[model samples]
Target chain A: MMSARICDKIATAIAWLAAIVILGVLASFLLYMLYKGLPVLSWHFITGMPSDIRAGGGVGPELFNSFYILVLSMLFSFPVALGAGIYLAEYAGTGRVTELIRLSTESLATVPSIVLGLFGMIVFINYLGLGISILSGALTLTLLNIPVLVRVTEESFRAVPSYYREASLALGATKWQTIWRVVLPNALPGLITGITLTAGRAMGETAILIFTAGTTVSRQAGDFDLFAAGETLAVHLWYVMGIGLVPDRMEIANGIGALLIITILIFNLAFTIPGRMLQKRMTGTRQ
Target chain B: MSATIIDHHRLKLMYDRYVRYLLFACAFLMTFIILSIVIFVGQQGLVTFTEVSPGDFFFNAKWDPSEGQFGAMSFIAGSLLATLLAVGFGAPLGLTGAVFMAKIAPPWLREIMRPATDLYVAIPSVVYGFIGLTIMVPFIRNYLHGNTGFGLLATSIILAVMILPTIISISEDAIRAVPGSLEEASLALGATRWQTVRRVLLPAAMPGILTAIVLAMARAVGETMAVQMVIGNTPQLAKSLFMPTSTLTSEIVIEMGNTPFGSAWGNSLFLMALVLLLISLLMIVAIRRLGRGSVV
Candidate 1:
């Protein structure tokens, strides 16, 4: 009994030590990056065209490419994902079909973004002749985003109480009406959070874009051309680190690195604050 | 008036059915997308095996594409080693942190830590890669006595951190999911809180914790940019952690741009995807059956 007691105390101490160290590590990593990254940010870094000249490249095109690609992906994926979410949450399923959807989505989720890129290259670039275009990358991204979007939207919609649906239906509303009006209104925050998260992912994604969207920094008038190759901010940062032939590769990395971190941080907070609040409120109200 | 009411009700029911089926079709369409991806990867991946024997593809020492050698033994080993190393660090830290978050932390700390973990999840892999590239790589080279500073060890550390949020978030939920009644029963028998947690809560939560570990492993193995940026992108196997090696993801990235269309090299990369996909598919099924009620 004495030995067991001693073992418990020691285990607890170790757990506490591990917990504190993990937390400290996470904190220091973020703080260190912010410290290292902040000094490199400037207006020119955000808007100036990247230069081929040594030590003079800017991230202006990369940032634009990131947003453009995100928009393109979201444009196509959002509707289908939201539709799937609605079906899962609002409709009582026939079991097998719903099971298949759940199974397929989960499977799709595991198909790595890198593989998705390779697949996109094969199908879109080779077969469809889209080349290394924004459209191809966007299509690949849509696949990556679908699983997460469906899960998020489903969860958010499902969190709305049964009573809300019941009341709406009893008031002479149809099932579709009740879902679209009563359920969707409540799930808007969740939808927003899912979209924001997906957007953040699209911006940060590098591997998928590597093959689907080529890495050339175009100075041509094809900035809006979906057929043109678009290298994203994450990919650009990666390029700078890997094969970027600039004298100031480190400086460019530092600058873009800060913006990428800040952009993601903003997206996270933007969704997470409301997402958490909505989650707490729903669970709280349920209890 | 009653006839009109009947007509209105019928119309509403029709609309409901139409909408429901439409949404179900959308869900069905998602299934189509998954199928197409598998088929696409399958069709392309199969091209490599036409000329290269399965034995040669798996066992050959060299992976030079220009020279037409496409064996992926080292890259496969590299990915496994990377995942193994990351899971080693991530699992312990994550499990302990989850325990602290769920049962030990004060409410105030929980509030802060919860959001911080969310932020961690949202941070880009490239940023991690960048930090690893500029900082960790050099640090290892200077202090850790590496030739070029990039290696398996640095990649593992980044991956460990990257997978940490997944493990902690899911495991914390699992711990919290353990019935409070179990803890109360242990306490009633005069066990300390630590004993209750260790003996009761953890056992009850074991399935969920396993699920978390599996998911984290999947994520770590699939991770690309961060691992690539710092892992030295060497095709051959390294003898030690302080040396450079390639992963499947990194190999695809490094070689794909230079690889021409319809080449044996290009198709072999797809075969790598096929392998990665099949493994994850197996894990996905495991998770679905085990984690039916859990959030991914």
Candidate 2:
């Protein structure tokens, strides 16, 4: 009996130790990145453009490209993703079509970003002859974002009580009217959260962009040419560290990393804060 | 009054039918986009499958894109080898962490750890790649010299860290789903906490645990940025984990540009995509089955 108790104690201790180590690794990785990266971060580093010999370069163009690609992709993906989500949650009958949709969405989610990159290369770059352009990259990212948004939006829609829909219908509102006036407003927060998360994923994405969004850092920011190739912050980070950029490349990479972290943090806050507050308000009112 | 009521009813019926059609169209559009991508990839990849032959692509070691002699065997092997190594090292640690979070940790600790996992997932793959390149590569270079910095070991370690979030989150869900009643029953039989977890709860949650591991494997295998950054991008199969190697995805990235349009190179990219698609399909199936089975 005493031996068994000792064994139990040993196992518990091991479990705790494992948890601590795993968490420690995660925390340490973040801290080390910031530590090695922060010293190089500066205002000039954020706002400046690239110079010769890898010495005096900044990521101004890269930042613009990242934002541009993100906006374009979101613009393309949002309506389709939301439409599909609504169909699945509110309208689809139990049949082959629904099953196929579900299976495809799941498969789409799992198809590695690299494969998407490959597909983009073949269809967008080769077949359509779009070349390596931001349009092609944005289209590929739209494909990537749709599956995630669909799933999240579907979940949010389902979470809404059925009575709300019924109440809207009972008031002589048409089905579309009910959805627009009642269901959509209630699900908007979750939908926004989902969209923001997808945007974050798209922003951090590197593989798909490698093929479609050419690696050239634009010299100017205001160019609205979709056909022109461009690089984003993430890709810039990869190129700088991978292939030796200017002299201040390490600092530039750190600044980019810091920015990437901040962007994602904003995304997470966008997702969770409004969500929790709305839930709290609803529950409080119920009580 | 009767005529007005009849007209309203007719409009309602027509609107319902139209809405149903709209829903069908939207669903069809989603399916069309996914299927079109698959078809496009397969159509383009057919040239490689036909020209290169299965034996050469799967069994040959060399990946000479310049000569149109493309064999992805080494890359495939490297990806699988790295993924296996990652799972070997990461699975136990992740499972233990999950168990601790779900069963052992106090409420406050659980709350903190939960968000930490979220933050881990939210960090972009490129950032992970950057960190690995800056920190892990130098660390490995310092210790192991020529064979260390860029190899399967570095790639595997980075992948292990990258997939940690998946394993922890999924396995935690699995462990938490294990019934308290089962624990009570084991304790009633004089089983200690450890015994209950090891013998009863673990067994019951085996499928969930397996799902978590499989999902982690899927993520590890599919990971590109971090692995690409760390792995030396060498196209060869090596006996030692310390030796440099390339993966299928990394190969696609490296060779996609050099491959001529509508040639075997393009087809090879498609072939790689097909492999990835099949693996992901298997994972989704496994996860769905496990999820359904564990609903109790």
Candidate 3:
């Protein structure tokens, strides 16, 4: 009994230690990556041309492709995911079809991103003859984004108070009208936050883009050619580290890492915080 | 005015009916996509057996593909070992962190840690690999005296960190779901906080924690860029933890670009991906079973 008591104290200390260690690791990792990469970052680095065998090159096209692919993928996925989410939240009944949809969603969510990349390679790149281009990459990324968006949409819609729907229905508004007008507006903050987080994630994604997007950027910065090879920043980072022959690949990798971290921080600051504030105000939750 | 209002109402009804079908189609698309992926990848992957025997593909260790060796046992072993090692290290720590958040942390601390975990998740897997390559690889080489310091140990460490958020968040939810009455009853019976947690709370939450661990394992197994970067990308089976090796993901990423789309080599890569897909799907099914078990 006395030993059990001692064990309790030890376990408590161990739990606290685990928390501190995890926090410490995160802090040190961010700080260390920033410290190493900060010197490499500049307007030139952000917007300059990448060198093949040279020392100083910029990631201009890769940066452009990252955001371009993100936007393209989101545009492709949002409507379908929104519709699915609406169906699940508003229209799904407790039946086999709903169960199957849910099971499919969960299964899709568990499918490896790399496998999705392969499927993209086979279908979009080869069978469809899209080649390894921005279009193919965005299409592949759309598959990756769908499950998450659907889940987020469903969750966000479910979070809307029941009374909103009840009140809209009571006013003789049609189901579609009520959903479009009231529930969606109320769910906007959560949806925005979810979308922003997804964008942040997609921006940093590398594996799916690697096979689908190809590794070479177009010579021109901000090239909007759908068939052009689209190497995003994350892929560039991986490429520079792996098989790159450039003299300053290390410095390039460092800069991209720092840039990605900064983008994530801005996402949290710019969208997530504001969205949370809106949610709190609308929900009337002070705590 | 009354005629226009009636016309508008009729139009709205028609629109509403049409939208329902659209939403249903969208929802059905999930099933369609999943089916397409399995069929496409599976069809491409199944071609390997026409030339190579399943016994060789599954059981053989040698995987040259140039001289026509199709053995993928080493890659499979590497993936499983790396995943198991990662779960071994990560699960306890993650569960502890979950317990800390759900039980011990002050509200202010919990607030900070929650976002911190989110940030951890947001950090790209490649970045984790980069850090492992730049920092961890060298440290292991010098201190542990490994040849390249790129192998199972390094891969496992990075993977453990990568999966921490999944384990922590899910397990935390599970811990929180354990009824408050159970805790109070244990406390009222002269049990300490730790005793109550260990004897009552953890048992009740075991199924959830198990789900979290399996999910973490699934993620660890499928992880590509990170494992590829750190695991040395060599196809040979490692004799020790420090020896260089490769997993299915690393091998596919390394060789996929070079192989012709319909060639035996490319087909083999597709087959490896199929194996990974099957493994993850199996884990999901296992989680579903566990979830059902928890209800009883």
Name the top lDDT candidate: 3
Q: Give the fraction of true interface contacts kept by model 1.
A: 0.64
Q: Backbone clash tally for model 3?
A: 2
lDDT by residue (A140-182, candidate 3, tens digit) is 9999899889988998999998999999999999999999999
Question: For model 2, how many clashes?
Answer: 3
- Write out the backbone clash pairs for model 2: A54-A246, A54-A247, A55-A247
**CA lDDT of each prediction against the hidden true structure:** 0.82, 0.80, 0.91
* Candidate 3 residue pairs that clash: A48-A58, A49-A58
Which residue runs of candidate 1 sit more than 4 Å off their true CA positions? A1-9, A92-94, A220-222, A274-287, B1-5, B289-295
- What is every candidate's C-alpha DockQ against the true complex, given to 2 decimals? 0.65, 0.55, 0.62
Off by over 4 Å in 3: A1-5, B1-4, B292-296
Give lDDT tens digits, candidate 2, residues A1-287.
99999999999999999878888987887777677767766767677776647586777777888889999999988877788889989987788778888877877877888888888877888789998988998998888888888888787788778999999999888888888789988887667666676687788888889889978855675467898887888888877777664777777778788888878777766567676567446534310
lDDT of 2 at A94: 83
Task: State residue A79's C-alpha deviation in candidate 1, in Å.
Answer: 1.2
What CAPRI class is candidate 1? medium
lDDT of 1: 0.82
Where model 2 places Cα greater than 4 Å from the true spot, the runs are A166-176, A283-287, B1-13, B144-146, B289-296
Candidate 3, residues B99-179, lDDT tens digits: the string is: 999999999999888888888878888899999999989988999998899999999999999889889988998999999
**Maximum-DockQ candidate:** 1
In candidate 3, residue A158 scores what lDDT? 93
